[model samples]
Structure formats: C-alpha cells, structure tokens
Target: MATSTGRVTGTARDRAAGADGARGRGRPKKAGPVRRSMSQHWYAWAMVAPVVVVTAALIGWPLVRGVYLSLTDATEATMGRTIGVNVIPSTYGFTGLDNYVDILTSGLFWDKLIWTVVWTVACVGLHYGLGLGLALLLNRKMRLRSVYRLMLILPWAIPSFVAAFIWRYLYNSDYGVINAMLKAAGLGAVGWLDDPTTAKLAVIAVNVWVGVPFMMVAMLGGLQSIPGELYEAAEVDGATPWQRFRHITVPGLRIVSSTVVLLGTIWTFNMFPLIFLITGGGPGSSTEILVTYAYREAFTGIRNYSGSAAWGVIILLLLVVMALVYRRALRKQGEVW
Candidate 1:
C-alpha cells in the first residue's frame, strides 16, 4: 500500500512540473518600446508616405527653387541658361537681396500693397453684410424660400472668369447696359472701369456679388443651428428684433463668421483673374493689386522672374502674419467659450 501511494504521488508532481514548463515556453518575449511602437505604426506610415513624397516633390521643391531664383539675377534671357544643363552665352550671378531692395524702393509696391488691403477689407465687409441680411430674410418662414435661395446662389455658382467678362461688358463706356440705364435716367454716363477710384470700386462690387452667396449659405446654416427657444425667450423678455440680432444672432454666428471672413480675405487677396480679365491692371495701374502687379512682372515684357519671386515671398510673409493673428484670435475665442 505504501509503495502504490508513493508512485501516485510522484506521478502527480511530474504532471505539475510539465504543465509549468509548457506555460513558460508559450509566453511571448517583451519587445523594446521603440521597436514595439514602430511595429504598431508601420502600416500608418506606409499609408502616408506617398502623400509626403508628392508634397515634397511639388510644393516643397518649387518653393525652394523659387527662393533660390529670387536670390539670383534671373531675367527672361538668363532664366533658361541659369537653370539649364547645357552651357549658354550669358552669365548670371547671385544678386543677394538686390531684388527685394529694388521692390522696397519702388513707390509702386506701396501703392499696390495699400490697394490690396483696401480691396480685401471692402469685399469681405460687404460680403458679410449682404450675406447676413439675406440669411436673416431666408431664415424666416416665407413664400418661395427655396426659389429665392436658388436664385441667390446663382452668382456664386458662376465661374469667376465668366462673371468678370460679364461685368466687363456691363462696365463698358459705350453701348453698355449700365450706361444705357443712366441715359434713360437722364444721368451722366460714368466710366466704371476707366477712372481709378471707380475701377477699384467696380472690382470690389463684382467680388462682393460673387462672394455674398457663400456667406449667405454659411450664415443660414449657422442661424439654423441656433435653438428657436433662445429667440422665443428673448422675445418673451421684450427684446426688439435688432437687439436679438445684435446679442443672439451675432454671438451665435461668431465662429462661422470668423472662418468665412478669413477664407474671404485670402481669396480676395489672391484674386488675380477678375482684376486681370476686366481692367488688365489698366487706368495707369490705378486698380493694380500686388497679385496683378506680380503677374505682370513675371509674364510681361522683360519677364523679371526674380522680381516676381520677391513679390511672391512678400505676399507669402503677409499671409503668414495674417494666419498667425487669426490663430491667436481663435485661441482667445476658445478660451472665452
């Protein structure tokens, strides 16, 4: 009996040891943090690699090349030779800030800069006013609301170049619809695109028309998002329409307004086609903005590629400053919220 009990006890101990040994062998080894992290994110990195490569090849390379070109004295005659593989006749050397200096010394730069600012502000302001007003009207219960919305959005749907062409015809001095209307009204004919002040105003008016529809749509969406209870409560408290708009509507639409205004400002600042197609920066460069001037410098006679690149850099710097300010303002608003 004692011998049998010893054998059973020894068998049980052997089984337990074997089980533990199996478990020890089955367990996985722990990896180092860096290797583990790379293993986890390898798929994501692979997915994004193509985009990164394309961006570097396209935008990054062009920007670097443009800066290099700006530092050199590259004109129409020398541009191909400077960048070409084969030897050429003319020699070009690095100007090293000369292009920027020339631009700063010219009075034309300041004038165009000032006009660009004015143009952007005027267009964005008018867009907000007209858009908000129309949004308010549309937000109310009214007849044919869908039809009105569709009609209002038509201007924005049209291509900017087409709209500019249409406006150019409208602003023509002779045989234009605007002049004909003035003649019928017994008022003197006005040179809409001929006079410098009027030309600036004309472009602004056209831009406002093209931009208002987008603002109206954005504001309308924002207005719809506001709870009806807030307005009802305000009215119950004897708040006037203007008071409600000022207090409730404006505050509710603040975020949307800021976003649209920033986008509008950028778009307006870069608006080249409308100004180029309509006035061609004419009337003695009266309506010329920085973008138009840069385009003219790059493409017109002499083709001052380096000068145009310098202008582009200045524009880029200005945009960067604006973006920084906008981001700071957004952070402040977020904190308030």
Candidate 2:
C-alpha cells in the first residue's frame, strides 16, 4: 500500500512538471509593427479638439500676445488707432530687454515688492493662525456649532468688494463707528487709511477677516477625518491635551494646512480689489502691491503697454517659482497636495 501511494504521487508530480515545461517552451509570438488607422485616432482627437481650440483661442493667444508685447515698445497709440474712420497702422518697435532692464533698475519696483511680500506674509500668517484656532474650538462637541459657523462664515459669504467697502467705511477717521467708539472711550480718532503704517495694518486685517473662514472650514473637515480611537488611546496613555494636539492633531492636519497655506498665499498676493477698494494703494503708494502697481502702469496716465506686460510677466514668474519651492519643501516632509 505504501509503494502504491508513492507511485501515484510521483505520477502527479511528473504531470505538473510536464505542463510547466510545455508552457516554458511555447513563447508568446512577438507583436508586429503597429499600423495607425486614421479613423480610429481621429475619433479620439475629435473628442478633445474642441477643448484644445477653446483653450488656445482664450488662454494661449492672450499669453502669447502678452509676451510678444512685452518685448516691444508697444502702447495704445502705437498699436494702431482708428480716429474718425481713418486707421493708424501699428508701428511699435521691438526693444528686446530694455523694458525689463529699466524696471529692474528702478526704486519703485523694489519698494512695492517689499510691501507686497509683507502684506502676503502678514495676511496669510494671521489667516492660518486665527483660522486653525477657531477650527480647533469648533471641532469640539459644543452646542450651537452651526450658528457659530454661519456667523463666522458670513464674511466670506458676502461679496469681497462689498466687504471691502464696508470695512473702508468702518475705518474712516471721521463719521465711522470705530472712531466714534474711540471718542466715547476718551481716545483720539486714528487715521486708519490716512497714515501709511495704519493703512498697511488695516488692509492686512481686512484680508485676514475675509480669508480665515475658508481655512477654518478646510481644517475642520480635516479634523473630522482623524479617527477618535487615536486620541482616546493617547488619553489613556496619560497624554496631556497639548501633547495629543501636537502629536496627533497637527500631523493629521499637515496636508490640509499646507494646501490652504499655498492657496491663501496666492490669493492674498494678487488681491487687487480689496486693496483697491479699501485704500486704493494710497498714502502715496505705500500699500501698492505688484498687481495694483501693474494696473496703474497699464491703465493710468500714458498707458505703458510694454512696461505693464513686463511687470505682469515678472509677477507670473515669481508666483511659479514660489509654488515650485513650496511644493518641493512639502515633498521633502512626505507631504503632497
């Protein structure tokens, strides 16, 4: 009986080995050269062709034209003007890097850039700090959470221009509620917009107010995604509140915080309307950011078409560099958005 069992097992093993040898010997046939059929590929391209056309016509053309103009000494008048049915042909000459050189050598650009950097940093810092604090408080199991959320989010819900106008009125040195309160408290009225320093702080505060709600909502969502078990376990292990927050909560929110910080930086950097509506880059251009300054170059006075284009291109390059550096830093820390 033992010899019979061994023979049967040997037969089964032989059969499996034979099957594997057969498969190994029969290699798959090599693929022939692929032939392209117009009919097959045309359909795929047709599906995406409209999007390509629209994008090229809208975005691509404008970008190309802006770059082209930036190299030339173009202005509204030189770009061709039609006066009383007689058309003046475009005769703007290309001047290579002259516009860029002139802009770089100027004192005005450096001053505006410094202020712009300060504005972006101050607003985004306050936005994230205040927003994360609020989000943490709201994440607790507290009553009237919805009510508090609505009240806090109202600033973001309102149109930005409208909010800017309202804040502008409130910051008015005369006939404003803020000043009225100051007077009631026996304090002198402050020129919030009239002074350079106060105007900077005032705009920064308005931007923070408008931006905090977005960061709070994003963080609150992140908080809810973290499992409760981790916090419970930490508490059981004798973890303090601060330890739990620093160890668990912060790591959980890092991805969300990084994303919001990048977005907030970009938005605050190019926030033209808020500054324009509030102080109009006033106090002799003390609060002028790059975007507002570029606007003045384009639309005000003689309408410096090429110079504005140069500034616009420079701003775009700066933003691209900032985004790349930020993403690389986050990637180093094992974070990506």
TM, every model: 0.84, 0.85
Cα error of candidate 2 at position 85, Å: 0.6
Q: Global CA lDDT of candidate 2, please?
A: 0.92
TM-score of 2: 0.85
lDDT of 2 at 261: 94
The models' CA-based lDDT, in order, is: 0.91, 0.92
Model 2, residue pairs in steric clash = none
Considering summed lDDT, which 10 consecutive residues are worst modelled in model 1?
A: 79-88
Instruction: Give per-residue CA lDDT, model 2, range 151-232, as digits (tens).
Output: 9999999999999999999999989889999999999999999999999999998999999999999989999999999999
Lowest lDDT 10-mer window, candidate 2? 31-40
Off by over 4 Å in 2: 1-53
Model 2: residue 20 alpha-carbon error in angstroms:
28
